[model samples]
Target: MLLPPCLPQQCGKDFRNSLKQPSPNYPYGYKTKKPRIVPAFTIQSMQKNTIVQPPPKCNIYEPQPARPTMFRKSYKRGEFPVTIEFTLSGKRLSWKVPIEKLDFHHYLPMFFDGLAEGNYPYSFIVEEGINDLVKKGSYKVLACVPQIVIPIKRALETKRPAVICHALKCIQMIVTGCDKVGEALVPYYRQILPTLNLFKDRNRNIGAGIDHTSSRGENVADLIEDTLQILERYGGPDAFINIKYMIPTYESCVLN
Candidate 1:
């Protein structure tokens, strides 16, 4: 009980007909879609399921409380035997006992602690005292290096651009004092480097295209680069590697 063979004209038509879908049998192989039944819910019911989100918290960099420096406390308490005299050069600390004869472990680190003070006299004394120490501290600086690091770390943690910039300058001062000073700082890279890395790309918000304030230490990014370069130069071979470990983004200043 076979049907008649398809002729050339009928073959095309029959083949096309065979290719047609045999589903819900809608035209163009489309199925007959069921009517959409949206859930029956009142506006109140819809509102019940809706979520109420709170406003986002502000993430702006608010100024932190200025940490009290032990140096300032001690100086005010008359512990330091230095008299502050205001000269044309600003402020100078004249030690009752010469700075060189003083205990490096105690007073050197004490002055370093004063670097956190943004106020006058204290700030001036810290800078002048540090310059004097760096110039005359001699081998005592290397010994006092470990003690000085804490103050440096504290200053950096303040996250104030000016304080951080000042701390970076202080870092360069100690690093330039001795070749071993840089290498000695290698172990403390973990402590000192985190803030540097945080501010590594940070530049001052200057609108002027030609930067008139292109001075060093003023720019955190430049200071960071220069500081690292100094570390690499004086830190021996292990310097760059340790610095790289702390700051993954740092490119070698010595290497091309």
Candidate 2:
């Protein structure tokens, strides 16, 4: 097969030429390409990624951070009492047992414990149950004040706008829920007012922009101040003193 003699210079020249030529890719070989010329603007853009990292997480677009609460555990365990009916108007909560028969010592704190939940049927049932209990339970709500403080504190401590709004509303309900509920709440001000104080100035200045949450009553700062006013109004003689002690920034709406 090697009968023909070849020149060394010619063989070397052929090998170098082969190295310069484009290698076979698929069906056929192609020409070698010059170095790519990227646009100067694109090069600058690639060097400095000018797009924002992302919006700060503190805003409301993010879902409320959930905390495990006793009521949530009970609901998951199917130990929650009351029957719910979803009707044309809205959801209706009915007691499986008579409202009068339900022990405040047992059920009141249990319903209050659900305040941390911001989602679904749990929020509805908890809010409705508390409302009904506050309306019907009479002096029982006042009696359960000591037991329910921790749940109230826990709900507000989450610093979630929605949960805090719900808890503040519940506090307002509890304060005006009946006679002496506020007075009863006075002693436990230390436990409850810290979160209130923390969120007391939650009133955001959107600068002439209409706050839809205000109309929806979902604003936490306003709710806190309103809750404080309700407390000051009904929390009896010592209520203001205790609230003032816990929340230094709170002013009396009742007096000058």
- Assess every candidate by TM-score: 0.74, 0.73
> Each prediction's Cα RMSD?
12.7, 11.8
What lDDT score is found at residue 149 in candidate 1? 87
Local accuracy of candidate 1 as per-residue lDDT tens digits, 59-134: 4444468978899899889887778777898767777887678888998889889878877778777887787778
Q: Model 2: per-residue lDDT, tens digit, 114-138?
A: 9989898889989999999888877
Candidate 2 segments whose C-alpha is farther than 4 A from its true place: 1-65
Q: All candidates' lDDT scores? A: 0.78, 0.79
Q: How badly does each model clash, as a count of residue pairs?
A: 0, 0
- Residue 21, candidate 1: Cα error in Å is 48
Model 1, residue 23: what's the lDDT? 42
